[model samples]
Target: MLTLRSFEQRDWPSVWSILEPAFRAGETYAFPPQISEAEAHEAWVEVPAATFVACAPGGAVLGTYFLKPNQPGLGSHVCNCGYVVAPEAQGKGVAYAMCEHSQREAVGRGFRAMQFNLVVSTNERAVRLWKKLGFTVVGTLPRAFRHARLGFVDAFVMYKELIA
Candidate 1:
């Protein structure tokens, strides 16, 4: 079974292990592939309103996610989130659970909506999963992401209203 909880300082190493490959791949997120551990820590943990980890029964972190306001002050009602699952944990519903958990957490925090600023169009699995979870593509930025392997690719700005 998998469990979710607020991230602890001890979780950083495991979280980094999951995030490093994805960020290094440069296929989805826009972060520089060469981003250092301190930079990633600040972005993933320090900057977010909250961060969480998905763990296995043995306490192994299977995935991680962060939640933050998509914008400041006037636009703060809408939140933003990012998720990363260990490569070994992919296709096992970790991302799905994290996304669902994020929505509930967002609503609890009084966010009226949730937005994903940059969903790489080429990441078909994530695009399909987000759609399955009721997020819609609000807009698309053509060639917005310069994928390390695929060159430039379109990116989607996905959003879902948390309130009725």
Candidate 2:
């Protein structure tokens, strides 16, 4: 039984554990492969306006996500989000659930839209899932991400209107 909920400070360790691998992989997020744990922690939990975690029945975090204003002042109506799941939790609907929850959460946070600034093109699964969840590729940056082994790769800027 997995449940989604607002993140707590106590959840940082588990959330960091999930993010660290993804950030270091250089296969998904644009974060530097050698990003330090402290840096990843600050970037994921502190920089974002809100953080959330999906937890197992016993309260162990299985995945995490963060929501933040896409820009400052005039552009703040659009929000951005990033997600990562524990490797063990893959294929368990964690990402789908997180994305669904994010849509509602974004609207509640006063954001009219949600955008993903960089969806790595090499990450086909993620790109496909984002599309399935109503996001559209509004733009593409050629060779935007330097994948760990694939050299330079394209990235998609995915967006969805969360409010009508």
| Candidate 1 backbone clash number | 0
- Candidate 2 vs. true structure, TM-score: 0.97
Q: Name the best candidate (by TM-score).
A: 1
Residues 19-122 of candidate 2 have per-residue lDDT tens digits of 88888888998888889888887888889999999999998899999999999999999999999999999889999999999989999889999999999998
User: RMSD of model 2, in Å?
Assistant: 0.9
**lDDT (Cα) of model 1:** 0.97
For candidate 1, what is the TM-score? Answer: 0.99
lDDT scores in order: 0.97, 0.92
Candidate 2 lDDT: 0.92
Model 2, 4: alpha-carbon shift in Å? 0.8
In candidate 1, the residue pairs with backbone N, CA or C atoms under 3 Å apart (3 or more residues apart, or in different chains) clash, namely none
The lDDT leader among the candidates is 1
